[model samples]
Target: MSIVISNPPYNMKWQHPFFAQSQSRFDLGLPPENNANFAFVLSALDHSEKATFILPNAVLYTSNKDEFIVKKNLVDKNYLEAVISLPGNMFESTSIPTCILVFNKRKSHSYTQVIDLKGKETKEIRDQRGQYGKTNTNRVYKKELNVLSNDVIKEVLSVIESRKNEVGFTKSVSINDIKEQEYDLNPGKYIDTESVDNIHRPYEDIIKDLNRIIESKNGVKITINEKMAKDLEIYDLMQDFKQSKELNKNMNEMLKAVNPNLKIKKEDIAALSRNKEMKFEVKNFERVPEMIALFISMWKQFVMTLNNEENRLLVELRDALLPDLISGDIDVSQNEYDAKEDK
Candidate 1:
C-alpha cells in the first residue's frame, strides 16, 4: 500500500464552483463555508490507501454540524486510525496549532487511538538570523520545525505498535465512546495531560463570584473620583504658574536678546498664550523663568493625560462590570452556598 503525506493549507476556503463540479470527491459531507480543512483530508483519503495529513487543531472538534457529521462518519466507518494533537507554534510561518490525522482504507481495529502531544518536549530554533549569524527579532522561538524529536517519535511508535493506553499521553478509545463524545476527535478530550487541572465548576457558583466582584467595583469608582479631583487641582496650579510675573519678565528679556532685525510682536506671544496647552515652540529662549514655565506646562499636560487615562479606565471598568451586576447574571449567594457545601 502506498503512503501519502501532505500538509495542506490550514484553513483554505474552497470556491463555490469547485465544490459544485467535484460532488463525488466529498462523499462524506461538504466542508464548511469558512474552512476547507476537512476538504483536504477527504481529497487525500480519496486518492490514497494510507494517508497522514497535517491539519489545524480546529478540525478535531469543530462544533459545525456538517464537519461534525463528516467526522462522525469517519470514526463510525473505522477509517480514522489515530489523531495526534501537536504542540502549538510548531511551524515558523504560522503559530496555528496543528494535528496529525492518520487514516487507513484497510480493515483496522474498532477503536481509534488518540495521542495528545501538546506541551511536550519543545526545541527552540532561530526563526530569523541577524547579521553575523545572531538571532535577530524579538519573537521567542519555541516552535518545532518539520522534524519531530526522537523521544516523541519513539513514544508515538510505542503507542501505535503496542496499541496500549498510556496515562496522560495516549488512549485507544472505542468508536462508541467517540460517538458518545459527539465525535470529538481531539486527543485532549480522551487523554489526561499530567499538567492540566480539569476542574469543572458549576456555572451558578462562578456567577456568584462575579456578583461579589461587581459590588467591590464601587470602591474602585470612589478612589478614581478622588484621584481625578486631585489631578484637576494640580492642573489649575500649573496654569497659574505659567502666568507668573517672573515668567512674563523672562519672556520680554529673551525677545529683546534676539536679533532686532527679526520681527517680534506682542501678538505672537498672545497667540501662543491663547492655547491652553503649552508647546515648546519658543526658540532661543534660555531664561530661567521661561524654562520653568515651559517645564511646568509640559508637566501639567503629562499629568492631565495620565489622569484622563485613569478616568477612562475606571469608566470602562464600571461599564464592563455594571451590566452583569444589573442584569442579575452573577449570584454571589450561590458561591456562598457552594462554599458552605464544601465545608
Candidate 2:
C-alpha cells in the first residue's frame, strides 16, 4: 500500500476557494483560505492509501467552520489512526507545539491510539547544533535541540500497534468517544492520570508512626505514675516536673532575667512532633511536566515586581527633576539630558 509522510508548512494561507475549486483532492471541500493545514492532508490522502503528517494542536478541535467539517469527516471515515503529542519547543524557530497525526487506510483496530510524550521529566533526545549555521568569519554558539531518537521511534510504533494502555502515557480511544468530544484528537483531552484515591503511603510507615505515637503517650503516663508513687502533693508534682524536666536551667535563668513574675505557659502533652514535612507543589496536568513550570511561575513574580519598581523610580525621578531644571540651580543642557537618558 502506498504511504505518504510529510510535514507541510503549518497554517499556510493560499488563494481562496478559487485555488481549490477544481482540485479533486479536496472532495471534503476547501479548507479556510487562511489555513492550508487540512488542504495538505487532503492532497496527501488523494495520492496515497495512508498519510502521516505533522500538524499543530489547533487542527485537533479548531472552531473554524471550514476546518471542523473536514476534521469531522476524517473521524467519521476512520482515517485517523493515532495522534502522538510531542513536547513543546519541538521546532527551532517557533516554540509553537507540534504533534504526529497518523491516517491509515488499513487500520486493524476500531480505536485510535493516543500517545502523550509531553512529560515534564520524560526522557528526551537532544543534539548540540549551532542556532545560526557557519558564517565563514564569525563563530556561532550551539544550543541543544530536542530530536527523535531511534529508540523512541520504535517505542511509539510498538505502542500504536499494541494499543495497550500505559497509564499517563498512551490510550486507545474509540471513534465514538472522539465524536462525543467533537472530533478533538489532542491526547490530553482523552487522557487522565491515576486517581488520588489510589495513592497511599507505605503501610509499614503508617504502622511505624502509630507505634511511635502510642509509645510517647505511654511514656508520659509512666512519668506521672512515678510522681504519684512518691506520695508528693499535686502542686509539688507539677512544680518538680517543671523545674526538673520541662524547663531547663537556662530557661529559668532567662525568665528571672526578664520580670521574675513573667512566665511562659507550659503544657504536658501525650504526644508532640516538632518535625515538619517538606511539600513540593506545582501545577501538574496529569503526566505533564512540573519543575520548569514551577520555575516559570516563580520568575513571573520577580518580573512583575521589577516592572512596578521601575515605574515608581521613573515617576520619582520626574518629580525630583522638574524643580531642579526650572530653578537654574542645576543647569541641564539638551545633550546632558540625552546622555543621562542613554546611561
Best candidate, lDDT-wise?
2
* Segments of candidate 2 deviating more than 4 angstroms: 17-22, 120-137, 197-343
| Model 1 TM-score on a 0 to 1 scale | 0.51
Number of backbone collisions per candidate, in order? Answer: 1, 1
lDDT tens digits by residue: candidate 1, 163-228: 789787899888888888878777867885455333332323333333322222111111113234
Kindly list the per-residue Cα lDDT of model 2 for residues 78-114, writing each as its tens digit: 8889999876445544334568899996777778999
Worst 10 residues of 2 by lDDT: 282-291
Model 1: per-residue Cα lDDT at residue 43: 75
- TM of each candidate vs. truth: 0.51, 0.53
